[model samples]
Target: MIANKSLSRLMAHVTPGRLLSLGFVLVALTGAQAQETAAPPPLAGGSQDEIKQFCTNIADAARDQRYLLQKQDLDKLQTEVNDRITVLEKRKTEYEDWLKKRNDFMKQAEAGLVDIYKTMKADSAAPQLQETNPILAAAIIMKLPAKQSGLIMAEMDPKKAGVIAAIMASAADPLTSKDPS
Candidate 1:
């Protein structure tokens, strides 16, 4: 056949070195083509589709677990807030009790102070009361009999007596007189 004759002619002209080089070139080309056409190895987990399906299956459960964790954190925060509120309430109760006891003691001390002032001479009591807190002096004077209060006021410095009188007036009518200052 004409093709066989041409192949024979081509083989006859090709040298041994040329044939060896041609074989190498062919092998190189074939290896490159094979590499291009071959599929990459599958991942350790599985094929892409299987991995995608696995992730899809776990998505809802993962989301639920995340939400549960968030809820637990919120619950813990709420409990801490509640505990702080309870402690605040306890402190408030203690403060109120302490204030009430302090007020009761002040009232008893004020009564004893008034009794001492009542027995003293007006001149002696006036100087002592003036040296005391003006508010305390005023309270003592108010508790004294009207005649004794007048005697004490008559003996006090006019400016101090006037300040005490204003305090007494304000105390008497708290709604109308808010502050002596």
Candidate 2:
């Protein structure tokens, strides 16, 4: 009760907009904490293969995301966002067809990740990769086609692009330090 009184007093001094913002932050933090604390569902005793299949399906879905992005025009920038969504639909259809024909869904998923990596390397090297800012440079490095890294670097400010490019190039290496965040 005393704690509540202090908190209410503190909140009272905050502007209405600030109070609402704090409320939103508090809600988000509490929700995330609850999710982290929630117990996992009990696993079925004999569903190992089924679990593998489920994971395979999810990875395959992820591959379609990359494929669809690849087909969309990145040069048009703003207009291409709409086209990318359409490409994603096409990729989904292709993934579904593959899943039906081949029982080895897991292999397909692994191959898709490799394909995405190659695509990113190529796109980032492309001469036309968007050179808007360090943030966009980082974003493009993830989805750019293989061989476009050089192009992104050429278009960007030397210092900022160089640092990000080095990070991109070394991502294949094992992590040397834990993520601070």
Candidate 3:
């Protein structure tokens, strides 16, 4: 049989305010229990292994993309370097060809000058010498025979002859010069 005294004591403590608070506590505990027993909807990504594999694939793809970009940059740089080298090589070849042509032209001009002067009359040579610069006239006169050079100089104006003579003297071999040293 129930103890009426203990039951009466318990009933006395269950006031309206205490009853509402007890109801709230019971509701909170049941709500937690319900949530614990329930299953959440499955994710669209499927199993944990699949999601892990997908993440691994994404990481691998990013790494491969970076590598490919670096490779492309290197290839572009290499192409630029190769193009520059080709241009420089072409320029070097052109310069060598130009130098060779210049040397050939100089030889031809020297030969032509010698042939013309050798065939030219002293009178004709004199007028040409007077028209040319003193330095060039001196060089041409120096290449002629002593008799021919004298005839050419005699035909030149006295002032022009003096200038040409001075240029020739200055260009003479040091050992053969009028200078004592």
Cα RMSD (Å) per model? Answer: 7.0, 36.5, 12.1
Better of 2 and 3 by lDDT: 3
Give candidate 2's error at residue 147 in angstroms.
2.9
State the lDDT of candidate 2 residue by residue for 69-149, as single tens digits: 875645467577768988999999998788666647644754664455455544344333333444444545655454555
Q: Judged by lDDT against the true structure, how good is candidate 3?
A: 0.85
Q: Pick the candidate with the highest TM-score.
A: 1
Clashing pairs in 1: none
Clashing pairs in 3: none
What are the TM-scores, per candidate, against the unseen true structure? 0.59, 0.23, 0.39
Number of the predicted model whose lDDT against the real structure is largest: 1
Task: Compare candidates 1 and 2 on TM-score and give the better one.
Answer: 1
Q: Locate the minimum summed-lDDT window of 10 residues in model 1.
A: 172-181
Error of 1 at 92 (Å): 2.6
Off by over 4 Å in 3: 1-104, 175-181
lDDT of model 3 at residue 107?
62
Error of 1 at 146 (Å): 2.2
